[model samples]
Target: MTSNPPKNPLHSARLSFRAPESPSDDDFFSAMVSDIDAYMNSNITNATVPGSKQAKKYQEYLTEKTLLGVVICLRSTHVDGNESEKPTPIGAMHLCKSGDGMTHHRSTEIGIEILDGFQGKGYGSEALTWILEWAFRRLGLHRVQVRAFGWNVRAIELYKRLGFTEEGRWRDALWHDGQFWDDVQLSMLEDDWKQRAERNLDR
Candidate 1:
């Protein structure tokens, strides 16, 4: 019988982040689209249906413009230790410049989406840690920001716990589920990230 190869090494305790080779990772992108809830669709992107033209277009745009785009994968180890299976892509995260010119050169916006099955598993936090390190240290960015619906308490809490601070809020900006929700803006400065790193080292 043929034996399988070992698992991919670019992984944390249970999650991995791999670069998207092209916009054609249809399976990965479709999985994310299928798992996004209505509220998330409203706040993140309007393309909800998998394999739709809009979704494909957006995927292409993201891959083409992304400074960094990663496919979030789940790793599994074999019992016998003979071989491990390849990680399965469960979601994605992207970091892109906010705009052109020197004024926006030091700022980037981040976006992330994880499938329903992988939620609440610390995978998002792990991915964020890796992305933030790349953003501040590798890419030499000064500011990183994300937007979330006020009703997305889970995401807001995660961002706060990771040292992001609320920068602003747009009142009743998003209309979803027959009600309006605030659009909350949160950001972390390079200095703040440095302080966080120092604190972690001390701990």
Candidate 2:
């Protein structure tokens, strides 16, 4: 299997951030149209697929509210795992920033979704680590925030392990299987990440 380092996950390897291309009708219909339908029809709470209803609505709201046009970063991998050519997108990370010049102490929200069949692998953790590092370093942003349902222990643990602290808790936030669960709000600051990164580097 191909291997890459998780520490300081981003290296000289080429990954570019660009506006989500003007989606073709099929892309829009598939990602936005279909996702909306799924969200409305199903009781899923953490659906993150692009064409799902929840994703589409969130996209619309984010674009209108933030005006940062969804910035997406894609991965390129060689089919042979050796030769370098067109790289297939194995994952994506979505980002939006505050329009006002309020800087790090302002508001920005991030959403991350890995393609189906890619969960449980370390890819999500690596991607998040690199992106948060970039946001704190390149963007000069102070805070990065995300939300996940309480039942998603994997995600919750991942965020916590990355030094994200619980900022808010909404009890009985989601209803499913004849019961309700909490929705958690998590945030990390540049200071927090810097401290953690320094410790890791020292170790």
Candidate 3:
């Protein structure tokens, strides 16, 4: 069985977390389809169709998970107690504690896709840090892993900054843009995270 960690004080960052559920199918489909397109076009250098079969498959997975859960929308931090700024929800991160086969354990593989406009500016880092803390402290996960091509230096740095260590690297795993690029695998355990957290606390 999977367990969530007790809420930690470090997670008091002023941000809102919304479970994956849109008001209507049309909204979900439109938003997700665009997200999938952005992910494919930006991440996969050699991606074909603007939307691929894999995109559809992931969409189907989200739609069929009415009982398990829906995709979450991570909103940005709100400024003063004034008018509420509408969130763009440019990026998405998936979480699942119950799964069949290899992933059925106290671990989760995070796949993040930020929209074209929100590629940088620390949003990815904030969202990932929040999610990892929730996974380790709130969900009591043993470990969390993320994979990205070596070319994605920004993401690599973000993962490392969040206490993730390089666990593996698949040399020349993907051939794109007329050259082969290596895939880097990064991971962080609960203990490792705590150590990092403590060190940061002391600093």
Candidate 4:
């Protein structure tokens, strides 16, 4: 709930997004991302063991999946009454392709995590918007998609607010916290993103 962003963070927004660059960054990610509570609504299936060499394993996973990862850090130019000399890693996001020849060139999926302390601080939405823009406009990607569990109402609504249209759902595909949950798929196509951009400009 406090502002402690470093000056000149990457990606040119309220926060920074870069690939993990050091041991400390990995440590921050391993510790913050290994929490059980954080995954309460997440659809990720692999749970890295705390205090393990998660970074290497994670990097391998990304390589195997051909995923591009970015670490989310505090980067602000606002007068939030605080500052940090070094960018603090608060969360991470990834862009992944399906690895199929048909879809690899045109589409990717996005996934993000906001540290527990940073939740509800408008960080997640901002990060997603930036990545979606980068995917469509910068990377020339045709489609960007995301998957959220039905039980995660916050995420479902956030994706909707960001112009992701519901594509379909895998009914009762996930079992977590003592019940079945639907895995909802949502996406934003290139034309859709362009249209949304025009609408925002007209606003």
- List the candidates' TM-scores in order: 0.84, 0.67, 0.72, 0.82
Instruction: Return the TM-score for candidate 3, rounded to 2 decimals.
Output: 0.72
Candidate 1, superposed: residue stretches over 4 Å from native: 1-10, 22-24, 38-51, 78-83
TM-score of 1: 0.84
Cα-based lDDT at residue 142, candidate 3: 83
Ranking by TM-score: 1, 4, 3, 2
What candidate 2 gets wrong by more than 4 Å, as runs, is 1-17, 24-83, 99-104
Which lDDT tens digits does candidate 4 get at residues 1-203? 99955644345456877776655556765765466556455535633344456555554444446557787888644375334456677877888866657665688888777777888988999998888878887778998889998888999999999999999999998877678879999999999999998999999
Q: Best lDDT goes to which candidate?
A: 1
| Order of the predicted models by lDDT, top scorer first | 1, 4, 3, 2
**Count of backbone collisions in candidate 3:** 6
Least accurate 10 contiguous residues by lDDT in model 1 = 38-47
Indicate the worst ten consecutive residues by lDDT in candidate 4. 43-52
Please tell me which predicted candidate would have the highest TM-score against the true structure: 1
lDDT of 1: 0.77
Clash count list over all predictions:
0, 7, 6, 0
All-Cα superposition RMSD per candidate: 5.3, 6.3, 6.3, 5.6
In angstroms, how far off is 151's CA in candidate 1? 1.6
Candidate 2, residue 27: the lDDT equals: 51
Per-residue accuracy of model 1 over 39-143 as CA lDDT, tens digit each: 263334543444456456556756687888778888777876422887777778889755556545588888887777778889889888888988998889999
Q: After aligning candidate 2 to the native by TM-score, how far in Å is the CA of 174 from where it should be?
A: 1.8
